[model samples]
Target chain A: MKSFGVNLLIAVIWLLLSAEPSVIAFAMGFLLGFVLLAVFQRVLGSRDYMRRVFALGRFLLVFAWEFLAANANVVWVVLFRSKESLHPNFITYDVTGLKPFEVLLLSYCISLTPGSTTVQVTDDFRTLVLHTLDADNPSAVRARLDRVLKRSILSFTR
Target chain B: MTMTEMLTGMLVLSGSLLILASAIGVLRLPDVLCRSHAVAKALTLGIFLMLLGLWVYQGEKQTALKILLAIFFQVVTIPVGSHLIGLLALQKDIPRWRHRPIDDYREPGNRS
Candidate 1:
């Protein structure tokens, strides 16, 4: 019930933010949400409100912190680096999180960071290839990612 | 000089410099994946700054919105394009530089 509320709120907010919105668009978006909710209910065997709230709280906290950290990292990179000799590399790291949405969030967060981007998601979503400007310390970032993902999973899945 | 003119001039100069820097980065980066990063971030920022300047000078809300939409589209698409290129590079086994010691992903058996 709460997830449905959250989803409905998201739909309304999206409608409000979009350019030149109309009743028809709102109806279309609502219909789409209904269909999605129906599908979600079928796949997950009903929504668990407690679990969803716990998961959402964890995601919000971690995501906010990661965003701030990424922004700070960007400031540091922009200030110290002189735009030369930046050896960029794409490296693959094995991922160990369940849930497709969590994986998607991780990838999007990586892409949002200034010097790093997510390149590919494996077929099973078990691994991701990431392109980073400072590939020297890729493991550190990967470790941080793992920690964040673990926290997310503990909050929601377990 | 007029305030608008000054702003425009600054915007154009900064935008061009950003573009040049991105191009240089792309050319100088060690690997295909790195180069893609340069193109995705620096190039997009350059273009966005440039468009923002043009929009500011125009001072029309609709035009500004359009420019913003353009930027939005670019931001949304650049990552996808960069990701695709990276996947292709990985498929080809392009080597990435590892100056640090703690890359667990770069273990002995993981040299692909």
Candidate 2:
């Protein structure tokens, strides 16, 4: 398969970078090399490697911070609050500006952001339906996610 | 122990604890949809920290780059898988808690 050749090529490159010249290093590189290909098949599509690298850095920093905050928010909700304190509701997200791939990635980002899970994306991909644990301020949630999280994800698609 | 080792240990410990918290969340949360929320968050954070820790410990360019790649893939996949599972829960007519104010599963245009 084509993936196999790509895998081998990465493994060779790995060996070159590490320069350890040991069997263990090569083996690890081969294994990890395959994984990089498998994992980043989408990311690898971009020919603009230089621009993408910077975008990737920004995306990672933003997501990492959001990820940690989401973890904390969910932990608190589950551990400290009783059912009475929780509010679960659905909200539809506007997906007009984003591409198909960006929309798909957006759902994932939304779900991982503590209080929300995307239940459905419309057939046309024009609308995304999300369920939030705390929907007290649906508009605020929508604005923030749209601006800070989902909008940033658009760069990855380009 | 070296500074890198200490940092790696801390990272791994925190990552494991996040995962442990996710497991508890699955049990404590009332419904599958809510549980999905907890699982998605915890899984992303947990795996990322663990991989980052391993990269720090390894201190090799190739291995570290691959680990970073793994984390990116894992993060991207978790939300999607969880989203599908949550969709299934909705399809099954999983009962919502009393606090649930809306059900847009029919169509957002239709409010019940």
The interface RMSD values of the models, given in order, are 4.8, 2.1
How close is candidate 2 at the interface, in terms of C-alpha RMSD after superposing the true interface residues? 2.1
- Taking the tens digit of each residue's C-alpha lDDT, what string does model 1 give over A1-158? 75567567657876887786865556766666655665686564445644565587877787656654554454444445654656565566776556777677667667655567888887777777777776667778678666765567456645
Q: Per-residue lDDT tens digits of candidate 2, residues B74-107?
A: 9788888888987887668778865454543356
Which of the CAPRI classes, incorrect, acceptable, medium or high, describes model 2? Answer: acceptable
Off by over 4 Å in 1: A1-102, A143-158, B1-4, B95-112
For residues B1-112, could you state the per-residue lDDT of candidate 1 as single tens digits?
8898899889877877767766775665566766676666666666767887887787755556677788778766766787788778766776665544334444333445
Determine which window of 10 residues in candidate 1 chain A has minimal summed lDDT. A70-79
| B20 Cα displacement, candidate 2 (Å) | 1.1
How do the residues A1-158 of candidate 2 rate in per-residue lDDT, one tens digit apiece?
A: 45556667877888888856765777888888656765686776423443454566788799778877899998888788887777777777888867788887787778877578898888877888888887778888889997888757766557
- In candidate 2, stretches whose alpha carbon ends up further than 4 angstroms from where it belongs are A1-56, A155-158, B61-70, B99-112
DockQ per candidate? 0.27, 0.46
